[model samples]
Target: MNPRRKKRLLFATVLIGGVAAVASLLLFALNSNLDLFYTPTEVVQGRNDGGAKPDVGQRIRVGGMVVEGSVERDPTSLKIAFQVADTGPAITVLYDGMLPDLFREGQGIVAQGTLVEPGVLEASEVLAKHDENYMPPEVAEAMGKEHKKMEYSEGQSGY
Candidate 1:
């Protein structure tokens, strides 16, 4: 091939290779950082209903109400374990860090971490509702009709 044509071909090859490399890097970053939100009911049912359960150690987010009377603290360490529940089911979460001041039972929360097993989440981050009336949109949506039932029950009990 002529020198000019050879040079042009080399340039095109390098450009294509660079583009592919960048694309691959972007995909990998996205896959690693993408955190999906699931409710406790969905997590439990997904494990038992022949649906694909999240692989252990895969990053994810779980959203629900903190189950009343489920909070346990080590007192010595920062480790805390609590159960989060949607209207249907509950999942236990273990976290070893400072919890938000607003974190409390019966309040809405989102825990982000990995699924350590079928019923437990090893949370790295915990987010609580900022206000009494505030609930994460994703949590509300995932709760589905169960939210209405909870509201009805709470109203009846005068909570």
Candidate 2:
């Protein structure tokens, strides 16, 4: 091949290779940081459309209404355990940190952490609705209360 043609081909090859390498690295970083969301029922069973459940040890965010009378705190430590449920089955979440003030039974919450067991999550962070007027639309809809707000005035559980 001519010298100029060889130079141009080499340059093009190097540029394409560099772009592909960068794209792969970006995708790897994104995938590692990705956290999938699932409902308690979806954790216990598969999705309604038969999607596979989150694998054990995978990072995820699960949101649901805190099951009434399900919060249990360890007297010796800051660790707390509670069951989060949607319309169907419930999944237990163990968190070892200060829970948000708004966190209470019958309230909606989202826990971000890893699935340590099939139906359990070891939460690294727990988030609760900041106000009565605010609820994550996704959580509300997943729990089968699309338009209704969570009410606990009569000592009832939102789930």
Candidate 3:
């Protein structure tokens, strides 16, 4: 092969390799930072579905209504615990930080953390709805499905 042709080919190969390497690195970084969102029902069902549950340390977001009368606080510290519930099931969460002012029972919330146990989440962050009519989109979608299921079951009972 001619000298010029050999040099051009080598340059092109190096350029392509560098691009691929950078792309792979970016994807790896994003994958590590990405947190998947699951409803409280989904989290519970996932644990009981007779399949492998999520890895204990994998980060995830759980969204649902804060179960009424489930909020407990440690007066000596910023620690708080609560349960988030959908129509399917509930998951207890432990958090050690100041909660958003809107956080309360019977309100929609999204907790980001990892599942430390089958039905427990160790939350690193807690987000609450901004207003009476506002809810996280994931929570809304999950609750909508729950509502439909309830309606269907009620309709079937008459038969």
| Cα RMSD to the true fold for all candidates | 3.0, 4.0, 5.1
- How much lDDT does candidate 2 score? 0.91
Tens digits of per-residue lDDT for model 2 on 35-116? 9888899999988888999999999999988999999999999999999988888999999999999999988899999999
What's the number of clashes in each of the models? 0, 0, 0
Give the higher-lDDT candidate: 1 or 3.
Answer: 1
Compared with the true structure, all predictions reach lDDT values of 0.89, 0.91, 0.87
In Å, residue 133's CA in model 2 sits off its true spot by 2.3
lDDT, candidate 3, equals 0.87
lDDT of 3 by residue, 1-159 (tens): 999999999999999999999999999999999998887777767634475556678899999989899999999999999999977778999999989999989888999998898789999999999987788998887778554322455447654
What TM-score do all the candidates reach, one by one?
Answer: 0.86, 0.90, 0.86
Candidate 1 per-residue lDDT over residues 104-127, each given as its tens digit:
899899999999898799999999
lDDT of model 2, residue 124 = 99
| Segments in model 3 whose C-alpha atoms lie over 4 Å from true places | 47-52, 147-159
In model 3, the clashing pairs are none
Candidate 2: worst-modelled 10 consecutive residues by lDDT: 142-151
